[model samples]
Target: MKERGQQVDQNSESFTFLGKGTDFKGVVSFGGTIRIDGRVEGEIHTTGTLIVGEHAMIQGIVSVGVLMNSGKIHGTITAVEKIQILKPGVLVGDIRTPVIAIEEGSRFHGMCDMGAHLGSGERALSLDMAPGLVATAQ
Candidate 1:
């Protein structure tokens, strides 16, 4: 029996969510998806997925399998799989990934390292952005 308004195919992976008004500092590591809508001022490492909400702010090193962001981030980020920054997201720092997608209205300014991932047979993120988007990489 499914509850009303429930998602038809909700993800089974339980994730940790840091909602608004929450502020965390130090290292946060998890194996499942995590959604942040607050502020984090330290390292965040995960082996699954990380979602940064529009109101979120993060600063420091981030290592994850996948990342979807619509907030603001400043630091060194390493995503083993891919990274997607949606509209209004702003990322300012160095990123090491093989595949990265920045949509229109997003912003990114940093250096990208993708060669290491290609030769290691590992997936990665990129430094590409669509038109009307602000992106600068080295």
Candidate 2:
């Protein structure tokens, strides 16, 4: 398992980096991995991994295959595989993922849905509806 994790990390190393001191606001769509160490306010969609480095700040809707956050984010996040919030990270948004891990000292303030049924094409419908309506549908 550790070896597999290492391999994944190695594969993700070839990524585009949004270095610190930068600020962006718009839609960002990409493949492979991306590491952000700056400020972003917009939508982020990717079919690969997203790494929010320490000191980063993001406010948007994030859709990705994997999310590893060590910064601050205020928005909704949907991960196809997993989401990990490292120590000192802050996430103030709703989360929808198959798996999630929040380390000690991490701060999270929002709803998290790790329902096993998320992949059956039903989750999108629920997400589009109002919160009250979603509850009634469930």
Candidate 3:
């Protein structure tokens, strides 16, 4: 079991770090994992993981497989897998994820939509019938 854990850790993708005091603005799309400890303003989309270190600040739309935030984010977040907000973290935006874990002392001031079918391959259809009338079309 221990060897399996070690192997998993070794197989994990390396993280690209955005160190403290760095500021970036624009779109970021990548695979694997990324850790940010600075400030970012734009959109971030990835199919891996994102770790927002303490003292980090991000503002924009974020879509990822997994999100671990320990700082602040002000925008919309759509995580396919899960989202974890550590203690002292702050999120001022809406969240859409199937699983969410928020530690104590974290601040999330926005709406959260937790649906099991969120990332499922499903489509929503609109009805074009009258309000009080039923329509049957074959």
- lDDT values for all models: 0.85, 0.86, 0.84
TM-score between model 2 and native: 0.76
Q: lDDT for model 3, on a 0 to 1 scale?
A: 0.84
56-122: candidate 2 lDDT, tens digit per residue: 9999999999999999999999999999999889999999997999999998999999884556786
Runs in model 2 deviating more than 4 A are 1-14, 116-138
Kindly list the per-residue Cα lDDT of model 3 for residues 30-82, writing each as its tens digit.
77888888888999999999999989999999999999999999999999999
Per-candidate clashes, comma-separated: 8, 0, 0
Any runs in candidate 3 off by more than 4 Å, and if so which? 1-12, 116-138
Q: Is candidate 1 or candidate 3 better by TM-score?
A: 1
Best by lDDT: 2
**Candidate 3: RMSD over Cα atoms?**
9.7
